[model samples]
Target: MTDNKQPASNVEDPAMPEDVTKESSQQHIAKDNAKTLKIRKVTNIILLVVCGLFVFHLIADRFIPITDLGRVRGFVVPITPQVSGEVIEISVIPNTLVQEGDVLAKINPIDYEIALQTAQQNVTQAGQNMGALSANVTASEAKVTSAKASLKNAQVQSKRIFAMADKGVMSQADADNARAELSSAEAGVASAQADLAKSKERLGSEGENNTNVKSALLALEQAKINLERTHIIAPTSGVAANFRLKEGVYAVAGQPIMTFISSEDVWIEASYRENSLGNMKAGDDVEFALDFAPGKVFKGKVAFIDYGIDWGQNEQSGKLAQASGQTGWLRQSQRFPVTITFDKEIAKGFKRVGGQADVIVYTDDSSIVNVFGKLWIRLISWLSYVR
Candidate 1:
């Protein structure tokens, strides 16, 4: 009774009770638990969505392969001269279209013309020499015939003279003279035969078959070819690019003076991950969007797939094979190139070589993944406008 009256601070207030404080703490904990549960549920939903997307991509990539690493490719032909000469005329303008056999340039044809004339004259002289050789051969044949007749007559005369001398009807001097004449006739025939062989050797076969005549004809033909080559013509239908040729410029043979981008053969080269090409094959349908022409999709078909890449190639440097070191836990996938040919002609102005593009291929016609691929490529086409 005395302590209660003395210490008012020791007494508990009705408004601040222990049970009430305990109840308030419990309420706060329940609210925190509810909030934590809600956060956990949201986190689970996000993880599930991400996993589902990853799985869908894996499945879709197999049937509908896509690649943003695509480029427009065309046959790049080097415009080079076959004969070195001063460029006298440039017939084509830079970045202009040309047809096959169109004159691209003209070299100094004066030297070639002179050479052609010289070749013609040489051919004529060869013909004259061949005719002379034929005449010599005929003359030698006639001489041989005459010598043979003389030899036969001398033989008969020598035999008659020897018989007369043996019967004492003719002098020994007469027999000796006849023998000398026979020997002379035989020498003449041998000389004529040797001359004939020499003439035949010089003449070879008659007419164009003669070695000298054939050589002259070949030289004339080569001169004509060189003269024609002076007028450089386009090898194929293409657009002339990187033109550096000008009048009076010394053009060297086998050196590229300009670049020719062939319009006849244009394709897309798409690089795809190695794992995504299992079902991909030539003749698959393809859709591509060029960076140059935004918001437009082009139709194409798979032309071919590259079988090999330059990586891991033996450079033949006579060194140890360099093992590429990888640091990460997951190795990076290798990419291979796939060629896609266009289904129709592209506008001549839009056909740029080495242009960028986004490409997708449909390996299966009935695959649902193709629907997504089609949508994705169109999306890429529209997106290209902003990029």
Candidate 2:
């Protein structure tokens, strides 16, 4: 009975058809094709994203300006003396703040004082000479007047003698003598006139306008200027640096005695690659950070861009340069300086001439690009601590 039951179960179970198997295989193939297409679409999307990022990077690099090659700069004034003298007293110390007109040092004023006195004496002597010349002129005029009176009297006598001689009342000898006297008086008057002209020439148009007086006046003015210069005063308000002057040190005229770094103003000079200045313009907003003061940002604006670079080359001198042979495929970019003036003075001790700094320029470009640039700048500023 068990064998019969097994045979009857086998008869009831039928084998699967070839068409069904084929249909199942076809469904598996379709599913595989759809999966492959979805994978390809995902790959294409990812590739597109990568290409977009690369293009954005290229654009940003060209448009957004940023540089870490920055240095603090300010006006450095060289203190020099206008007159040569031996320093008798030293006033200010090194690295000390001083105001304009503050005395820095003093020279031996004795010599200058003597010079002034000499000038004064010369002026006085010139005045006295001028007065004497005037007196001489007056004397000459008086002599001329006396000579004129004598001439008039001589002429009257000569006429009367001639008349008397002609009328037979006087001798010819007397007439001749009277004529000779008139001639002598005329000669005397001419001599006096000549002397008066000479005296007037010496006197000049005015007593003060005499050549000697004028020259002496100029010397007097120069002496006063030298006397004032003996006290070496500051030309501008600033911090005195490298003041190595000492008492008894002989200072030559126009020689720099010390350096005065102007504390009233300061600026930053940012050096950037030449190609990075295309979008930059004067008055563009700038942000900078000093390495000395970490995590602090400063505001500034582009003042000017230097028009030249010190590339160790000069204008063609007709001689060909000995060029070095090409060693590599890389070419270094040339840098240019850009001057940036601060919006306000930074805190004391934080400002240093030639201090290292990072700078970023905000151009009126795409706001999106600007946003990214600002973020990068802030990040760099924060990182200035470790760097």
How many clashes in each candidate?
Answer: 0, 0
Query: Residue 187 deviation, candidate 1, in Å?
Result: 0.9
Segments in model 2 whose C-alpha atoms lie over 4 Å from true places: 1-57, 310-330, 344-351
Model 1, which residues run further than 4 Å from truth?
Answer: 1-49, 312-322, 327-329, 344-349
Q: For residues 18-125, write the lDDT of model 2, one tens digit per residue.
A: 777899999999999999999999999999999998987666656668889999988898988899989999888887778889998898989999999999999999
lDDT of 1 by residue, 93-124 (tens): 88888989999999999988999999999999
Quantify all predictions' global Cα lDDT against the true fold. 0.90, 0.86
